[model samples]
Target: MPKALETLVAAGLMSSLIFPVYAQVKAPILPGTGQSVQYDTEGKPLTASESSLYTGQDASFEATPLRYQDNGDGTITDLNTGLMWQKSHDTTKRNLTDSIAVVEAMTLGGHDDWRLPTIKELYSLADFDGELMKPKSGKESKPYIDTDYFDFEYDRRRPFAGAFWSSTVYIKGDVQNFTQHGGLQGGFGFNFADGHIKSYETGKFFDGTTIQKSDNMFVPGNYVRAVRNTTTLYDMDYVDNKDGTVTDQSTGLMWSKSDSGKRMNWVEALEYAETATLAGHSDWRLPNAKELQSLVDYEKVDFPAIDTTFFEVTPSQFESQQDSYYFWTNTTQGDFKHTAVYVTFAQAWSKKNSDATEYFDWHGAGAQRSDPKSGSPSDYELASEMASDYISIDNWVRLVRDAK
Candidate 1:
């Protein structure tokens, strides 16, 4: 057995063996977030002292680094996930139905097994090194994806038009009215332009006079980038170490069984994770965007959209409304320093409008969004005009470390 496995086994035994003993399971490897640069709370590049001050940030630890190879043909291969991708996406945007049809008819790279990627698979291409440029800043915005490895472009007319469709549907539906059809079925998509995973309506749109096909309609649609060899579905195999930590045999990562159990700003959360010592290990660090998102168990559409069996989760109360909390990731938003990425393990709430008193789940559980790194939730303006009136500046923390 490997040294890491032996260590985990010994640790498990020492802690009083629990039911379902530690066992290895083969699972898809998750690629790193491709974020190498460290940032301070303000989004400025971190100095050595600042980096040390914030010891357990994303750049401090390394996972399986992202590796991609572009075939001379019109395809790119992600070495980490063993998935081949279309080098360039169709310029024309389509609804979910049409997007699926396009992939069915696609015969790229001399192969016919092309299909749409799941939210996780598509998210593997996200690169935090890219910068989000302010709209009308007269500066070109950098995309959250690697433009060199894959073809990418921004819609000059619609600044944030880079969302690519995924096969996974947002379980809570389209309460946000992202498309012409309001309050309808929706599917998840990744917007590389601004760096978020959101749900877009999948139904066809109706013009003032009549319903229109996606090809002729001007309603909201998403780009398509076909992928192949997606044989593995999303799965997480977790084992309870029974010593305040859990091991995911699939990804070879061990995590704190419980969260900080309190709300904190991004900097505080980072420091909390870095300085944490748990389960007789001191190498814990805050997970990057990808690492943190991998823990979300989308199967649970209710509160705490994770496997509560091995992890402890607590809901935060706001105005008598109990809601799942947003957990911070070490990655800073590409476009701005004031914001950091977070994954909503449960319902992502939004006010009905700026004047509304009630809040509803605008984005479904497992959605990925950004939050202000510091200050009171009310102190900052909405992260984006498209965002809900509600925002949560103070978030939660969960620490992770490579099993050794």
Candidate 2:
């Protein structure tokens, strides 16, 4: 099946996966606070959602904290997400084919539990807040990863080589490299530059029966990082703090009791969250695009991608009031200054909703996408503009704080 037609189903790992799967392992922890806020066209805060700090959102810094412990015996452990990692890469620079074989055949520290990590698993190790950073010695530049946790070589020969191969051949039903901002053909990879995860192509072409490398053709390959499980990774596990907040058991992120309760522009949404003191927590902030999209449930297709039972989403009965299904994300539309990304909880992703007028690129109905940060209120023609208590708006805000 074409990758574009595929949606990530919440099922057991495919039998074809080369990595060894523990029943419920959440190995290869994700790094980065999930805040990639940048400047807008005028050099002002790009969107109200963006933070002045390079660390994106301050609350996220506490939520998805970069906590790790390096085991001298060639391994690293993430304290936030209990995932173990191989401290270094192959350094030999092999294509995707050899890379997989190298990890599978190896026995590290009298243990043979090592295997290539999935795209999601591989991403759990990135530290975006530290990208392009320089050490005290004044080196060229550094990737946004914590050198204390994982070992990565700054290959001068292959400058753009932070792209690491993931075990997932197909992601979200699209070939790893088939997304709007994707990589090669064989699988997906995590680009460490801005900490963006996209589809990466391997040099080989899968000819019905076999996977062959593009030896005749020049194949610029990515890195290989191995992962192993520490414990089970949960889904939809949340804890209501009685203080009007909900904490996710799996990701360790705490969310607001409800949304902004009204539609707002990008700036307004940011301010609303920044000033919010609900439940006695004043460190609330708008979630980035990826952070917000993480709430989606790919297994649910009828009403929306989010878990309606957990979140207060009243989709059918809002016609009489001023409300919008969209929420703003701090992610800029690629590098466009005027536009930013958003997600609609009320939309669904499917073949029937592929039409532009009916759906967005994500196929998941509104599929968190880009829209102008500031535009005419009628850009979406929302009814809120007509209400006396309403003002110009584009999206809503869903606040989150670091879970203590």
Candidate 3:
């Protein structure tokens, strides 16, 4: 017997033609299956009841907040906010007064979703209509900016202007170089002349004057734009040294160290840290000197102003290298002295020379020096073998780990 006929006969139901006719009509399929059902391509998928939701709205409703520019992605951006956003791009450092004012103005609008823009939000706003100029509000909806975003009522005694301020603090100089680590080089492309976007590193400019080789001071007043951090850094574990020295758990670095007065070389200290096998980590390096100093608590320092809970150290750590209190730093000064710098929690001062200052030359690279106090020659061998010819005398280093 044929298989189809046998099944039909056993079921005691359909004839052979009935089975063929049933097969001819395709079975109903569930949604998302390959089978086609009814759906409108240009409209949303909705049941008859759901389709009636928007039926009673008046056709004469006009959009509020004055002007809107199509964002090309089916969304629209406001021109008022655009102007404010541009001003923020012009800023380098964060100005709480400006930022809060902008946020307050935005909150007054009907849109409650408006919040402080993130770094990327502001970063994306760069590179307006080519040539570093901002997009203007014209027929092109060309990056519309409203002149009425700010209230200059206090300026009645002065002159009234239509321009408004942005929440972002724009740094006038090529501030990109300031953002680098270890070396101050390379920056994202930008148009220097008109503040436009060009390439990944278009406006690469450096204020060589801001960097002091004589002293490790970076000019704090140079305009710097502060960007609100969007992504929260997570998975970071802080090392609790329990003394006065803290280390980064991920990279096994002394997260931050205080320098009172110490003679330790940064390179040697970093090498020591790199070789350290703490908690199964071996990639420790010297924390940028600033990272070390951040641990200091100026309000409370018996000897060195430092946070006691997070660090591990004793007065003996500064006494000598084997039990030295002095710590080394990777930061070099532009002094004619071959001398490098260090930070010791022992005395709590940002000094020019370390403990072994008498050992190095004034301007020469070799390890030789004329004593300032005794006026005598001295040959000072490094207390530790972890030093190179490039290393300066009396340089002590503290270990640092990358923040996880």
Candidate 4:
């Protein structure tokens, strides 16, 4: 019995009873969602947010909002616009070469992986044939999200749209290829300054000219829209045709040229287009909204109306103030009783609307302005200063000719 007891004690099974043993203590482990909380060798918990380990596939732990999408394709899609563009897109797209490079090198959202959108991806946001008057007032969905991407210091909504360039090559018939619109749509089927999905509409305007939707597709030149990208600075130069029509070099499209003092109403601008003559060229017509928008330079705020070269002076008699750097487009909104869309050079933005009555008089089957010397004036006024009598209210008018 003594030997057996000694054996049990040696085995330690009865050692606790034999020796005055203390209670054993164990640390408690908490249950969680399996996301590991980091710790040092001493077992102290780390303060970092609980996240999955960096798997090479989805290693974009530091990407910022509107910065990147971990597509797991070794490349990430730009969250700002859902474009998975290559680095080359930035280099070749337009004036955004430096901007893209800077973004690429940034350690944003905690990761250094960012790139411009490819043509296929970037143009995917176009709203071809969508309503121009209310271009971006649509519902949102998963595959399509119309969110503003440009956050430049000059203009908060620089990336929204005017016109942008895409990386895709537009191959027209007869080996005539063209650069894709920044919105990747044809004609003015280009994308909106604000990101939104668009539905198709008849490309034809009041006149018989074939206008293409501002999308990535090809059609006739019946209608034209405007666009600009961060990669380039678009300048507007005016051609002073002593005749009725004036040519806007920014779009290579002409509009009825008005003298700085001629206060012809909308009718006059149309008439100027109707009676224009340049180097034996007739067939001139007043530019529609998109055609007018094509000439706006968002970066340079001076002389926002049309191109400076086109005008001896900006028209101030129209609704928008000369300092406002915005003017009316020929296009009218669907049902806004007294409002019309206009472009502002202050930010290269095309999303502002002005009043109709104060800046213009729709008398004599056309439009007229306080400044009668300028050719034709669209009927509109600035939102803030409803005073139409200000002759110094600078504005611009452009003309267009049939593409034939």
Instruction: Locate the minimum summed-lDDT window of 10 residues in model 2.
Output: 383-392
- Sort every candidate by lDDT, greatest first: 1, 2, 4, 3
Per-residue lDDT tens digits of candidate 4, residues 207-251? 222334454343321111111122111234566667655655534
lDDT of 3 by residue, 195-287 (tens): 221111112223332244454533211111222222211112356664444554422335534432344333345345546555455645544
Models sorted by TM-score, best on top: 1, 2, 4, 3
Highest lDDT among the candidates is held by which one? Answer: 1
lDDT of 2 by residue, 193-309 (tens): 434444444555443122344333456677787877643333657777877678876666788756666676675666677778888888777776546756655445444445666
Q: Over the full model, what C-alpha lDDT does candidate 3 score relative to the true structure?
A: 0.29
> Scored by Cα lDDT, where does model 1 land?
0.75
As a whole number from 0 to 100, the lDDT of residue 214 in candidate 2 is 35
TM-scores for every predicted model: 0.84, 0.56, 0.28, 0.32
Clash number for every model?
Answer: 2, 17, 58, 71
Q: Model 1, 201-309: lDDT tens per residue?
A: 6654322122356435344789999998863424677889989998877667788999888888888887787678897787888888888888887656556778888
Candidate 1's C-alpha runs over 4 A off are 1-28, 177-182, 204-219, 231-233, 316-322, 352-357, 383-385
